[model samples]
Target: MDDEQQDGRAVRVERDTMGEVEVPADRYWGAQTQRSLEHFDIGRDTFVWGRPVVRGLGLLKKAAAQANHDLDLLPDEIADAVVQAADEVARGELDDHFPLVVFQTGSGTQSNMNTNEVVANRAVEILGGELGSKDPVHPNDHVNRSQSSNDTFPTAVHVAVALELAERLQPAVDGLVLALEAKAEEFADVVKVGRTHLQDATPVTLGQEVGAWSGQLREAWGDVRHAGDRVLQLAIGGTAVGTGLNAPADFGPTVARHLADETGLAFRQADNLFVQLAAHDGLVAVSSSLRTLAGGLMKLANDVRWLASGPRTGIGELRIPENEPGSSIMPGKVNPTQSEAMTMVVTRVFGNDATVGFAGTQGNFQLNVFTPVMAHGVLESIRLLADACRSFTEHCVVGLEADTVRIAEHLEDDLMLVTALAPHIGYDKAAAIAKQAHRDGSTLREAALASGDVTDEDYDRWVDPAAMTRPG
Candidate 1:
């Protein structure tokens, strides 16, 4: 290694198979990382798009060290130092050391090298060695022992996706489900007009409508959980391709076991390493599930906003929390801003799902070359959905109220109530009554009474809005 000064700061020359390159002396990354930084100035997205990827890489490297040591393939002192440095990376203590953009090599080799160099350099520092010196612990020989970017990058993607689903998205969805369930129970008795094709159809309790939203969310949550389960299979130990070329037979399983212990997640080696390396079906499944969830959320948000349309002119049956002004010019106007934000998040998730699906199909030959972008898409979807659910629950769903006066007005005014009179009177007579009421702007009760097709007592007993909410 050579030393020099540039930009008034110390710099060091680091060498790879290609040649020597200048890296900032202050940063822990080495030649490969510097090369990537100089070459792939493609996007603003770094490991920061999902910090969990950095943590996943750290956990993977630390576990690899432990596995290598247990196999007697690494020295105890070297492994111990690597583990310590890797733990710092896992805990986000050295996030600045990883600066590679997500748009690097399709196999994410640059990111893998980025992690290895940071850990190796930090391990060197721990061993009282100079930063650029590959003295006691070489990045490839020890820090990334028994692993390849092809396998380890996908493994890191799995780890990151699984942990984010379990630790962040699941809890947020549960909170939203609970909030909807509580509202359903609270509004159980508030009768309102049901709509079909945006036109009044029949009467249904506000509780039933909200309960349907909860049920849809519950189903979506189950799908997401099931998809997340598929991500527990890691692709480590498949060194260069799917054959486990340079790694020991048990290397993948050992690394997976260590990762499980470290993360408290049910990580296991893939039954078929070839499939794991060549395709990202698990991530695609997770992304599809997220898309399904986005659909559900979109429907729920749209329904909420529609129900809470206006206090005077619109549906006005449901009153949502007025957290902010709806417009810049219209004073005292509050919109369903949370619902709008959630719908926007749903749209983004849809786009991410499409990207993930298309990316999943790009696996050529023995390995998928679209690992980094796939990781980014799936992880971004998870993050956005989780945050949107939490915000929607806190700002909108929890504070939801029923406008009983408006609900009753709509329920009473709806001419579809003439249906109950059909079974007693006749379909043709009931239709006539409904049409007459709509044309003359009269109440169904008045039209039916005036038609002389039903008695006042029978009309009162037949067109009960509360009773219409449930099956007879």
Candidate 2:
């Protein structure tokens, strides 16, 4: 620790802000990173930036340091020490002690510095030295040796997002798929009219409609998983903007092997180091797939909510959970809050896609200018979507019940369902009779009875909407 006199006071050991204005002592981070926190404060959202991404990145560095040490690329002592410190931080041995400033530095230089300071301090302490002592395994010289901001920043982003998708997104999607499938089975016996442009004209099983949503969700889950698979494309080998400017040629493959061993993931060197260094398109690609999944989920959730509207007022078939009083001015008024929350999360995911799109465009010749924002945005989107899916499934979809009386009432009054009777009465006669039935405010069976279009026994035998929409 260094001490100095400033403003007639004794100042000991300059405080690092990672990027913001420096502190005399007992501080970390720097001026620019501090300035960023205040300058780019967006708005109070239910979902904000989180510590997991940063923590995951720290783990990545530790793991990387170990790999590099084992590869003989860096000093074994430093690598082992860095890995040890990182392991402590990872296992929550040092809670909130990994002092990363934030995602700043155009290429996250501040965050890199933050990592350097924390690891260096921890290592110094482990080596029987004072905190912040840059000796033996210097933070940048040894711990971050053979790496650069261009590659490290994006690499960490990939690791964090990929892990999150594997650990969080997949399980939630599985839950959603099962929920939809269960609903399909529950409503399988109830046949109803199918509509085009809200104008019903044919028969359909309520189960079949719900089953379609299940198919859509299952496909979306596959897309999400495919996108995650791409995230395993790590950039650790392509150092310093892909020129390998300061990196050893043999270092790349060794580090790759180490990463594969450490992560139990299929990590490998980028075939084209140039592309990996100068751009963050891999993350953009993965995030875009997530956005697509979010879009499908939004449609499915809203449709379920609408189809499950009411026991007396709306579509009134599926009954969502009564979590809270939906209306302040009315009694027994429950709303689709779970669906609304899912919709809101989808909106944010879509919005993050726009930012990812913008960030992609901003990647100039050798680097992208907006790394921190892009990574932060995408990470937040993934987390929110996963959380929303879990909440919606457990609180809303899983507990949903079917209202029998409502389905029966809708089936009895639906004149559009005359398409079921078409095979017996002929199409033109069925259409004419359905219009007449609606005008006369009678069941299609009664209207057909009055119009002499069909006999009661024939209506029963041929006009069964339940059988027409059923799979033969």
TM-scores, in order shown?
Answer: 0.98, 0.89
Please give the distance, in angstroms, between residue 176's alpha carbon in candidate 1 and its true position after superposition. 0.7
> Tens-digit lDDT track for model 2 on 1-472?
5655668664345334342243334433223333444554544221114555565557767866876776677676677778887766545555344343334466776566556556666776677765445666566777677887777767777777777777778888888888889988988888776767866556777788888887987887787777777667767767777877776776666666665676676766677778776777777887788888898889888887887876567787778889999989999888899999999999999998998878877877877768777777778887898899899889987888777777777777778767767777688998889888788777888888887878889888777777778665
Worst 10 residues of 2 by lDDT: 40-49
For candidate 1, lDDT tens digit of each residue in 74-184?
Answer: 999999999999999999999988888889999999999999999999999999999888888899989988999999999998999999999999999999999999999
lDDT of the candidates, in the order given: 0.93, 0.72
Badly placed stretches (over 4 Å) of model 2 are 3-12, 15-49, 92-103
Error of 1 at 121 (Å): 0.4
How far is 186's C-alpha from truth in model 2 (Å)? Answer: 2.5
**Looking at model 1, which ten-residue stretch has the lowest summed lDDT?**
42-51
Candidates' RMSD to native: 1.0, 3.4
- How many clashes show up per model? 0, 15
